[model samples]
Target: MPFIIGTPIPDNKILVQSVSHIYGIGLSKSKMLCQRAGFGDDSRGLNVTPHKSKFLENLMDKSNLLLGADLRRFQNDKIRKLYTIMTYRGLRHKKGLPVRGQRTHTNAKKRAHFNTNVS
Candidate 1:
């Protein structure tokens, strides 16, 4: 396939999967990211330019993708922000109800350690 935007994509079919190789980017979201970055829906894994590669690497690193950011970065950030709001102990203070949302009275067994029976 012709190189997209003058960038040579990697020949590895697996690497071009968008979501599998990238952190903070899921299959769907990866498509969006590629779209945003002007990378069309081509199955080719463009070898990011040196500058682009550095930019992406740095971006991923700063975004807390130490292990990976493909899709978890978004979730990680959300959970982290919630925990910060409750001072890391808000979960316990609020009876294990997720500070973000979720019905506590019926579907919160994992967090209810004070006096709840899982069975």
Candidate 2:
């Protein structure tokens, strides 16, 4: 059986890489999660017994880390806040341009391109 985290089921393979499939869990965090769950980095997800899998599930539930839909909602809320504030970044996002001060002269031509088609 596959290990389900949030909406995704991780395939039975390297434990660290499997865990990293969930949102907000990077390589380092996945490694730490594997260590915390008493599994070796190379341990296969399929090899995890029900008891160990339950423990891991509980650990994930208790952690502050966001996953799947929750992570998406959180990010959307952040962007919404930025838009509401009308800050410089918000303006850039509103305009569909690069928010981080990238040169718009040439590199951001894709973003700067306007739809020429008229109804």
Candidate 3:
């Protein structure tokens, strides 16, 4: 393949290390996105090709996955929407809790207290 200058290659490492390059993407979520994108969990960033880069960008756009350049836009939108819906429901959404019909009894982070002052 001809060397494409300036384009990045997406593989396991990049997915794991710096997938935040995409909009709405973060470390934990990026791993899941990469998994769903079929790049495996341990892929490297340098291995990504121009085609993969295009695929990733398209995938992120289509699925609301975060990537390069416009991440803050999504963050701001999410924050704004969260505030607009502010209520127990809005707080739930902001905290990433189960909103629709998921059980939280098994894992309630908010219910549990983390006291740094105890130290």
Tens-digit lDDT track for model 3 on 2-115? Answer: 121222434433455556544445677667656766777666776666677666656666775344546677767876787587766556555566556567777655532442
Query: lDDT of all predictions, in order shown?
Result: 0.50, 0.76, 0.57
How do all the candidates rank in terms of TM-score, highest first? 2, 3, 1
Candidate 1, 36: how far from true, in Å? 1.4
Q: What is the lDDT of residue 96 in candidate 3?
A: 62
For 1-119, candidate 2 gives per-residue lDDT tens digits of 55546534455568778778887778888788779999986798677777887887778878877776788899989988998998988777777788898997779877656624311
RMSD of 1: 8.6
Residue 93 accuracy (lDDT) in model 1: 44
TM-scores, all candidates, are 0.34, 0.78, 0.43
Sliding window of 10 residues with minimal summed lDDT for model 1: 1-10
Model 3 accuracy (lDDT, Cα): 0.57
Tell me which residue pairs clash in candidate 2. Answer: none
Cα displacement (angstroms), candidate 1, residue 43, comes to 5.4
Write the number of the candidate with greater TM-score, choosing between 2 and 3. 2
The candidates, ranked best first by lDDT, are: 2, 3, 1
Q: Which candidate leads in TM-score?
A: 2
lDDT per residue (tens digit) for residues 23-101 in model 1: 4345664555445444456645444555655554444445454334334666667666766696644444445445556
